[model samples]
Target: MKFNVKRKVIMQKNSILFVILSAFTVFMWYFFFVPPPEQSYRQTAQSQNTAAVSESGDNKFKRADLNESDIDNIYVKEEYINIETKQYKAVLTNKGAGVLSWSVKEKNGQWVDLVFPESAPVMANFPSLTYKIISKSDEKIVFEYVSKEGWKITKTYNLSDLYMHNLNISVEKNSKTPFPQIDLKWGPGLGTDSKELKENISLTRALVYTAAKPNKLKKLKDNSEPASLCKWTAIDNRYFLAAFIPENSTDFDKILLSRLDKKHPCSVILKAAEPKDVNKKDYSVNFYLGPKGYKHLRTYDLGLEKTVDFGFFGFLGKIAFSALTFFYKLTHNYGWAVVMLTVIIQILVLPLTLKSFKSSAEMKRMQPVIKDIQTKYKDNPQRLKAEMLNIYKSQKVNPLGGCLPMLLQLPIFWAFFTMLRNAYELRNEGWILWVKDLSAADQFMQFGSFNLNLLPLIMGIGMFFQQRMTTVTSDLSQRKIMYIMPVIFTFMFWSFPSGLVLYWLTNSLISMVEQYFIIKKMRLSS
Candidate 1:
């Protein structure tokens, strides 16, 4: 009878663990492994257009109605001007007085160009007209174009520290005609490499800062008529960003996004506000084209840091990342920093771990007594429940003890998961032998044509032993399923980033050690 009671309790614990494990497996599978949906560009663009129109209720705001007509019978010499700073190098062309290319220097001594080479007319308002170089210098360049109608367009670029720069545009006119529509644009796609863009295409998006927050636009869509006015607009990917921040939000409120061309599928456009007077119009924009580093973005005070999506438990993830960076500052090695953070986390959760271990250990010891009581009350279900309750009360055992601890730890696990996966600091950063890049899977050895990741395997082994120490269930089926959990996790984590796997590995090792000592101490007390 007592055996039945112990079995029921064990079954309840196993069921909870199984449910939680399965849920986590499903979550990880969807987020990390599943490929994005495949759709045609035309279908995607139409869908986006429909959604945008519906959201706006009416098309009061004009679309990015830039005229793409050729400049007939007009000749202007084209010139390319290059500007180099310690942080980045930018090339500008007199053809449209727009940026030809901007490449930011990385710590690994590699240049990550933000502009896609295939996407021409990048960040240009007038792509067809060639402008004359009015002025050129090491830090600044000015281009001017005078139309046959006697209207002049001048674009001046001023370099600033880091990846920040300023573009001042002015139009001088002597006509009663309306001011020509102007929009600064960038797109098709932006990323560190083609592979990154291809894999993380879903992460690439257009963002408009409006109403004190960012309103994100759908990817691969013709979103050329967002409803609200924006302070700025941008095209951002997983690691880098190219944004246009108007010096005065009032002057650049209309934001447009278009993916009309197959070659240039995503274009972010920031339209200039209509000038009250047609005689002269001037606009200044602070352009930021560089990494999405939290520290760097925070310095700009433009809320660019919001671009980093930290998931639901973002507050905790931010704190975890902060701690990680703090430890890295001390150790000067991210691998060592991860180890330190894991140790600190284990220490903080020690109280919950100790309580869970004690509850499970106590329940294991009460099995024999519980079985005897169940037998005595075999025919009396109500009395059996009452007696079980009495025994729990006397023993100070909370039936939910073990389950609650696991539940409480889940938030921390998810927070770390989100933080480590999106951590830009881990990219290309090496940890130890064969783990050259923490952001990539650790390939310790090659078995013929198969590569084996050593970290996840070790982590799996640690998890198996940790479960073995804590598991009190005597049911054969439950035990089998419980034992298989480690193997299942091994394969799931096989392709995960090494830094994330290292955190889990260190966690499992710590839990096993803690469980071992707890078991030893319980035996001594008995």
Candidate 2:
């Protein structure tokens, strides 16, 4: 009696699992998969050689054209002062006192470029366009530039222990000179390392973080209108991000955003406000340049982490990412972390998986008998229906038992997919030899435009095995049709990120193992 009660309780739990999983699967596929925007990033030294000197050639924001061979030759040869932290290294040039390079160090110990000077238009005066370094110290650099009217402006940048910096700008004046609204414009574009500029340009835009939420503005067109207020703004990209956060923006209420040029589809933002009325004449802001790692970005609580978009299944994506990171903390390598996640999820769903596989096998075994019954009652539809029900009851098989459990797990699968596609941490991380950059394709060779991706192929092969291993009961035509799915998915996922392909492939291999043992046990018992 105790065993019977325990059995009923277990059955009820499995029944609930089946209902929820099946419903989620149906809903997900019925609606199709849709995801949301937009971005995340890292800071690295990938300076573009192209230099565009503005038509106005304003001294306040002038850059050496390097168009003339003489200047180009001299520019590269010139020394730019650098400041380094544990996570990043920044190079500041005397040409504009602008950032020449910003490189981030990744887990593989490989340094990559994040700042794309060619596309990025300078915005703020903290590093005033062309300043002489009057004084410097470890983790700090001060730049000075004198206006033609005799106003000496000094911009000091001090590196904090975090992946950020403090910018303090003060103007020295003996006489009252009406200081024009403090205008610092940034953009042209962020650095593009993984993809073509046009392919990623749309993803690069100005982001303003308000008290309520962050707003992504493509271009700020009308300067006459009052600018929206925000705590910070960033130049966002698909995998890298840069933002300027004012230390005190209470007075910085006005903003101007404009298009730089058509060649690069560049966007620029001029964040300005009247500072004369403020108690302190100095302006200060914090600048952050780095990858959009959730754990890394969440430290500041400024909604900066929202840049790492998780799409439609954000709630699930966050949970999945947290799990992935949790495992990463234990395993260190992203590849191993994925494997660990897969193992844990698989174990949790094992009971339902086993129940489904068993049902499928049983259904397959009863197929021969069912086919005979259909023929026996060929013309009698009503009789055939009744006969089929009895046979199922006698055989103690629930026809939906196979599909329900499998369907129940699809939500998790979708969540996992969404998380991996946007997880910035996977960008430069590796799994094994030759499979660097899990966020990208694991392509080993390219012939013309056709590249060979080994993982997807392995995924297809495992899929084929799993397909073959799945006992087919419906019809010979259906079995043949099912064989085509592996081929379809292989090509479809051929160009997908390595991390995604790895997860599917690992799932398939594990499923194949489980199916084999389950089928063997069921057959022996029968």
TM-score, every prediction: 0.83, 0.73
Structure candidate 1, residue pairs in collision: 1-374, 1-375, 2-370, 2-371, 2-374, 3-371
lDDT (Cα, tens digit) per residue for candidate 1, span 185-226 = 776556465335334455667776654444532332544644
Query: Per-residue lDDT for 1-526 in model 2, tens only?
Result: 0122234335645654564455456445433432211131112111211221232222233322212332333333334787776787777765555666777776667565655555332533433245677877657888776655446667788887667777777755544554433544455566646432334555566666664433543233343223446667777776777777887776465554444332233333444554553333677778887777888898987778888878677787899899999998998889989988988889999999999998888888888998898788868766777787788788888776887898899888888987898788898788998788798889877899888999999999999889888845555655665676677677767767899999999999899999999889987897
Alpha-carbon lDDT, every model: 0.73, 0.66
**Whole-model lDDT for model 2 versus the true structure?**
0.66
List ranges where model 2 is wrong by over 4 Å: 1-86, 94-96, 124-132, 148-152, 171-177, 195-199, 202-205, 213-229, 254-270, 276-280, 370-398, 444-451, 471-473
Clashes of each: 6, 24
Model 1, runs deviating above 4 Å: 1-33, 36-70, 73-79, 211-229, 259-266, 367-380, 446-450
Worst 10 residues of 2 by lDDT: 37-46
